[model samples]
Target: MSDFIPVNEPLLDGNEKKYLQECIDTGWISSEGPFVRQFEERFAGRVGRQQGVAVANGSGALDIAVHALRLGPGDEVILPAFTIISCAASVVRAGATPVLVDADPVTWNMSAEQVAARITERTKAIMVVHLYGLPVDVDPILELARKHDLRIIEDAAQMHGQACRGRSCGSFGDISTFSFYPNKHITTGEGGMVVCDDPDLAERCRGLRNLCFQAHKRFVHEELGWNYRMTNLQAALGLAQLERLDWFVARKRAMGRRYTELLGETAGIQTPLPRTGYAENIYWVYGVVLEDSVPFDAEEAMKRLAALGIGTRPFFWPMHQQPVFEKLGLFPAERYPVAERLARRGFYLPSGMALTEPDIEKVAKGVKEVLG
Candidate 1:
């Protein structure tokens, strides 16, 4: 059997080890250190944001962003049903209700039109996720936000370099969050960042990540907060990962193109489309929709691939159907038809940074064999 190709892998070939060694030598391995500050500044600059606050993980970053927005009981934040549960969990954790909406089938992102229709007096924000590294149609979303005076928080965990109209994903939202898990476009082992242009919000994020104390004094705890700080070691790794972000994104794009080329003609499979006016998609994971005419369902295909040492994953389950959310009776299961269908039929192949051309061929061949 061939070596198993993963869905995604981090590329850390730069000064990661050297930076880590420096951190160890300087005894600044904890959350408070120069490396963390430097990493935040560099990442903020890269994302065209004025500030970046490092956190323990992407979920933590979301929690902090929601807190900064002051979204509490009686407030509702609109989000896509077909997204990682963290997007909804963060809102619930922040004491706000998550108003789930359907995703646009082409973009696999929250539908701006759907969001516009769902807004109400209780709606305080809209959380748009750039699912699978494809930038959500932010222009319309931003326009809607402006008209309604609603905050837009981008869940950019899977889209590190994705852009639209020359602006990066993180720059489009009032507060944007990124993940650095190993499977992401970049990795810091396990870390996240929250970026924003508002100085007060940024400062509040910094405080929220560190016990909500006034930064000047150590023993001051002015408000509620959590210890969601990232360590210097993680920042060292992040700096290294950031250095290779462009290279990683380029290789991922190349792989995505190759996949489309190889699979476009395959029967009963629909490749994702890159819309005009969108910036380069980083292809965090290469997703394909299995038409109803396909010989096998997504689960069966995934099982066969796993047996062949080729790992595959299904798309996110719609939040409305989740047991925890179902009990809340907030929305009916059949409301988001697109999201429900995607959850049942969509699956992504391995497009890891480490994947070679032959790996792509093998995956394509395997899928064809299974389907045929």
Candidate 2:
């Protein structure tokens, strides 16, 4: 039997070890260490942002960004229902209401048309979450923001190097966020960042991530905040990884192309859209959605794949379907059919940065066998 192929493993064959060694030798493992600053500057510049505020993790980045924008109490943040719960949770935690929108059938992203329809007098912001490997159609959303005098928060946590219409994903919003989870194109083990062009918004994020520390007086706080600082060790790793982002993206695209070629003719599954007019699919995880004719859903598909030593992961369950949100008395009558179908039928194969050609072949074979 072949070894079990996990869903994701990061590629760290760059200067990761060298930079980490420097940090250990220099005793700069804390969040205040020099590498944190360097990483922030480089990453911000890479994403076309003027400022970057490093945070503990992706969720923390979202929290800081939401608070920095002052979204609270009666403000409505329009977002896609087919996204990670953190998007909705961030708005909810700010005492704001999250107005859900359905996803595009082909792209499986937030529908910009739906966003225009959902806007109201109280709509304060639009949270654009770039899903999987494809950026949400952001130009229309940007137009909507401008027309309504609303703020934009781009969640590029899953879209480090992705672009829409030649513009970098992180540069499309008033404020943007990125995640450095191990499964991402670049990994800091556990880290995230908030990036923006506005100096004031950037400063607000920095203070919010550091417990709202006062510049004039120590241990004095005018407002509440959280300790969501990213450590130097993580920053060191991130800097090294960032150096190889272009290559990593290319490698991922190759892996995705190979998977598509192998599985293109397979029945019962729908592959990711290879490209749209705006951008090509980065194939973040080489996701597959079961067709309605398939006998089982993603859960059963994952079970079968696991038995064959092939790892798989289900797509995000729609926020509208979340019991917690239902309990919160949110979206009582709202229904997003596309999101609901994708959640039930979609799952991703192993498409990690560390995945080799042989691994891709094996995983593709396993998928075919299981689905057959």
Candidate 3:
């Protein structure tokens, strides 16, 4: 029997150890180190932004970004219901309402049409998520933002190097965020970053990161904030990983293409597909959505795959359908068909950066055998 394949494993063959040693030698392993600054600058520039604020993790990045916007009660921020809960949680944390939109089955991102339909006078922003490394259709969303004078928080946590129409994913919004968790396009052990063009917004995020202290008086707090700072240890790892982002993205894309080629003819499931003119499927995790005709859902499929020594993960359950949100009376009558289907039937294969050709082939074979 072949070894069990994990859903993800990061590649850390670059300067990870060397930079970490340098940080240790300098005794600057905490957040206030040079590597943190270097990582922020390089990552922001790489993602086509003018400034970057490093944070403890991706969720912290979202919290600070939403805080920087100063949203409050009654503000409505449109976003995909098919995304990770953190995006919606950020808005709710700011005393705002998260207007949910369904995912586009092809792109697996919020449908722009749904966003427009949900817009109202109170709508202050649109949280554009580049889900599964597939950039959302931002052209119409940007146009909508412009018409309504609203902000866009581009959640590019899964889209380190992915782009739409030649523009980088993180560069499309007024404020953008990322996550450097182990399974992301890159890993910092655990860290995240915020990128933007506005100096004021950037400063606000920086202040929010460090307990909202005034620049002149470090300990004097004017507004409440959280200690969501990233340390030099994580920054060192991130800088090394960021240096190889292009190579990593290429490897991921190759993995996606290979998996699709191997499983394209399978009758029970559909592989993640890229839109011709919009974007290529970076296949962040090389997801598969089961056909309605299939006898079982993703849970049963994952069980069979696991029994074959293949590790798999289910897709994000839609926010609207979540029991927590339902308890809060937040989507009482709201129903998004596409998101509901994705929650029930979608899941990704083991498309980690460390996966070799043989590993992918074995995983594909396992998938075929289990689905058949």
Candidate 4:
């Protein structure tokens, strides 16, 4: 197990220890501490947003964002069918219907055109995710939302430092969310943040993150909320991670390039290619999709890689095909062709910021050995 390269490993050789020590010394370990606000401000500033409200985790951030929007059962929120359940689950939890759209085969993000087609009078918001470090073609989404008078909530959990055209991924939306899970661009171990330009929505998210209690009276609650607050210790860790985010992003990009260089031409597999010009694919992980000629699906390929002491993860299963959705009768009649294919064919190699050149080489070599 020690010799096996895990799918991800957090790189924390920064001020993480120093700040954590400071928090311990000061006894500022709870959610209401200086480090929390500092982390919020710096992160919001980095993402080009006016405000950021820290939460417990990515799912909690999504929930708070949807809740802040005040969406309900009669309303709808459009998002990609290819993403994690958190995207749709947030909408479902807010008593809103989740409208699923197919993914773009090229970028693997949701198809903006498909999203445009799915919009109805009841549509209240469009949640756009910059999937796997590749920014969604969000200009058209912005235009579509503007024309329809709908809000855009950007999921930037996997897209730190990635841009769309000239703008930041999280800046195009009415509100945006980020995750600090260890595998993400930056990690706070388990944390998330909601960023936005509107002060009122910011306050709403803040209130929603904590129990929506009145500031005047701590025990007096005006609305329902969750205990989604991020502790000062988490914030201390986050601020440390944020300090070297640029370096982390650069290292990841390099690792991705290395994978593509090694595996781009591998038989029966389509490796992720880096794009230039504008906002390039940061290759959150160097994903590969097996062609039909391949003898194995993602599951089989992953097994083979595991035997080689390599780590890999399959692409997210399409939301439309999920058993939970099927049981709930959510997307029984819906289909997303690209997402469906990618689910079976695609998988990503070890791509954490901690990966070394040799680590990437080993992964690429193992992949070629498996699929060649």
Highest lDDT, which number?
2
- Report the Cα lDDT for candidate 1: 0.88
RMSD of candidates 1 onward, in order = 1.6, 0.9, 1.2, 1.1
Which candidate order results from sorting by lDDT in descending order? 2, 3, 4, 1
Comparing 1 and 4 on TM-score, the stronger one: 4
lDDT of 4 at 350: 89
lDDT (Cα atoms) of all candidates against the true structure: 0.88, 0.92, 0.90, 0.88
- Residue 356 CA displacement from its true place in model 2, Å: 1.5
Error of 3 at 302 (Å): 0.3
Candidate 3, poorest ten consecutive residues by summed lDDT: 273-282
lDDT of 4 by residue, 271-355 (tens): 7647734578887777888898997799999999999998889899998988987888898778789999999999888888788
| Candidate 2 off by > 4 Å | none
Residue pair clashes in candidate 3: none
- Clash counts for all predictions: 0, 0, 0, 0
Give a tens-digit lDDT track for model 2, residues 213-274: 99988698999999999999999999999999999889889888888899999998999899
Q: Judge candidate 2 against the unseen true structure and give its global Cα lDDT, from 0 to 1.
A: 0.92
Which consecutive 10 residues in model 1 have the weakest lDDT in total?
A: 273-282
Q: Candidate 1: where is the Cα deviation over 4 Å? A: 215-220
- Candidate 3 residue 49 Cα shift, in angstroms, is 0.7
> lDDT of model 2 at residue 42?
98
- What TM-score number comes out for model 1? 0.96
